[model samples]
Target: MEPVPLAVGLAALLGLSSAVLEVHVGQTSVVSIKGQQAILPLWYTSYSNSRPFVSCLLERRDPTKHLQVLTYIDGKSKVDEKYFKHRVGFLYPMPSPNVSIAINNTQEDDSGQYMCTVNLGDESSTDGRNIGLVNLTVLVPPSSPTCKIQGTPHVGGNVTMSCKSLSGKPSPMYHWRRTGPSFQVFFAPVQDLSKGTLTLTNLTTDMSGTYICNASNSAGYSNCTITLEVTPAFNAAVVAGAVVGALIGLGLILLFALQMFVYRRKKKDVQEEMANEIKEDAVAPKTLSWAKSPGSDVVSKNGTLSSMNTAQDHKLYPSKPPSDTASVTTATGSMVAYKPPYNNPRGGTLTPTPSLSSQSLPLYFPPTVNGIHCHHANVPVHRNAQHRTNGAQPQAPRQEHTLPPGLTSSTLTRMGAVPVMVPAQSQAGSLV
Candidate 1:
């Protein structure tokens, strides 16, 4: 009895007339367990690209009519029961020219040995030296790792996470990897690297994830995926403190500006008050002082022409405005106008009669060089300032004159007031 071939898989050739699946096929092939259904891929043993492939027709070699076509696999032989039982196609013409084995409806269990042999026939003659071997050990991901999580301590603190509940023999190789990405692995047990713990010294948002612990021994590999779920340590308390501090600083700045404004306002008010006082003092009216004079400039003895001086500087002086009293309505009316005897002509000056023009106060003062000959003293000094008018000082009133010893005796009677003559003894006493 000849031995059956250890492999059964697809075979292809560029141009071949006869039906013979004789080339070394790849570990993964296009095979279907149920007609027109699905396909399965095997990852391990691969075909050599250097050789050409050929697929043999099954009905040409089936010695018994009971023999049916079936396929097989290599590493995943434990999952091969479905591929043996499912019907594929019937053999019609012996040694048919082209027989295409279309793949359909495949599952993980359809991964192993299949055959095209006669039922109750010699098993040795059914398979040949060019065996059909498919390496179909499929990958099965382990359960999700169950573990607790904690937040990162501080900004610069380190963090770590562990993977648990992995099965198999040889104390499986632990590879710390993360899913949702293909990263350069930091640890793989085949490379004699680190174990389950993944440590990050300075933790940040980039360090969090669903970590894939690739645990593998000889019993085939699996992945225990755990999520680290790292959270940031920054909080609201620190930000609030900064805002409060800024507000306090702004308040201090506003208070300082207000104080400066108040100080300037007060200083300007004081300056304005001082300026007003200076202006009042400058325009106040003052008395005029004159020296003793010769001739008409000398004083006269008339108690009526008082030389008054005010005791106060700010005393009020009201003067009659131009429109206060009536004026001469006509020159003819002036001849009958009311007049005062006090507005008479000066002493030593005889009036023939009052003229129409010279009504009162005749010879108010004659224009002279630097002097006036007054036969009377004018207004008295040492009186209240109410007598002053506008800013003008009051002129002294006329006085009655007394004749000198040498003048004629009638001169004394003509003058209404007397001259203030001091006795020679009194003058001598003043000089002493």
Candidate 2:
């Protein structure tokens, strides 16, 4: 039992001595810039009197496994040419307690946990205590940020000022401040530090000026500037009123044009109606005038002097007889014989008989049996003796008269003037 207790005590002492020879790391974390060098520190204390064979290795710790970065064995050093190549090497010669390694030309992909393991000759301690850990971070400086203004910079409107960096390690923080004479450090505007934005509410003209944004991280800082200008608000009411007034004026003009069009159309219609009435009146048939007595003068509606022959006058008034003494009577009436005086060779007028003189005669006579149209007031009455006989009356001779230009027989009849057959001899100074 005493021997068993001594063996256990000795085993515990050996484990303590081995633990004292384990590797120790300095600075659990390290930060460096890209394209620079990084150092993973490892050291150990010697417990034995004589020199011991030291073998060490540096590995990168991954989520799945550990990757060999560098190795030292038999006083020789070798790096994983597949990954680290010549960029990774031991900082000091082997066979010493210091087993630190340097990684030159570090990149972003080199940022990860690194471990250093040490082993003594023929003493491989699998207890996992002879190892050192270091976390490396390759930092990238903040780039030059871009400043921009968003939203309309009008009075009483909300606006946003933004700052952006194309690349930065550990994400840069943003700070916004106004520059120029209006700047005040304590009066910094409200901003989102993570998103690099500054928000302004209810903007005013006084806020117009140069603004600057600073993006900073542990590595370095970059700044950008922008100018803000707040303009006066637009007057929408005035524009609307002007537009409405223009529309109203245009409408009035159109309405006036429409009224003018309608008035012209109505005026044209009235003129056409009046013209049609005049045309109807002109085309209407003229009525023949009725004489009250044979001695009465016939006048047309147009006030033209007109006379009709006994045949036409009797047809209109069958009970009346013509007043002319030379006119032949019907079987129911008595005829008054007329004897014309001889015409004077010097064109002197002959006295008419009382019975013929009492009758009103037409101003002009139709053509006589000699085919001569004569005026009662100008021509002398001429009688031929051969036209008369005792109790053997000759019929009156008919004559045709050529009407004046533009006058037809129907037009003359409408005017109450008709040609009639008359005796060649008439009462002296009496119209035939």
Residue pairs whose backbone atoms clash in candidate 2: none
lDDT of 1 at 255: 93
| Model 2 spans with C-alpha error above 4 angstroms | 1-20, 47-66, 122-126, 185-189, 234-432
Cα error, residue 430 of model 1, in Å, equals: 99
Model 2 TM-score, 2 decimals: 0.47
lDDT of 2 by residue, 137-246 (tens): 99987899999888988889998889999988989988888887488432345788888889899988898888899999987899999989888777445666889999
Quality of model 2 by C-alpha lDDT: 0.61
Worst ten in a row by lDDT for model 2: 313-322
* TM-score for predicted model 1 compared with the true structure: 0.23
Residue-by-residue lDDT tens digits, candidate 1, 274-375: 999898779765433321222113232221122221112102221111221223222233323333222223323322111122221211222233465332
lDDT of every model, 2 decimals: 0.36, 0.61
TM-score of each: 0.23, 0.47
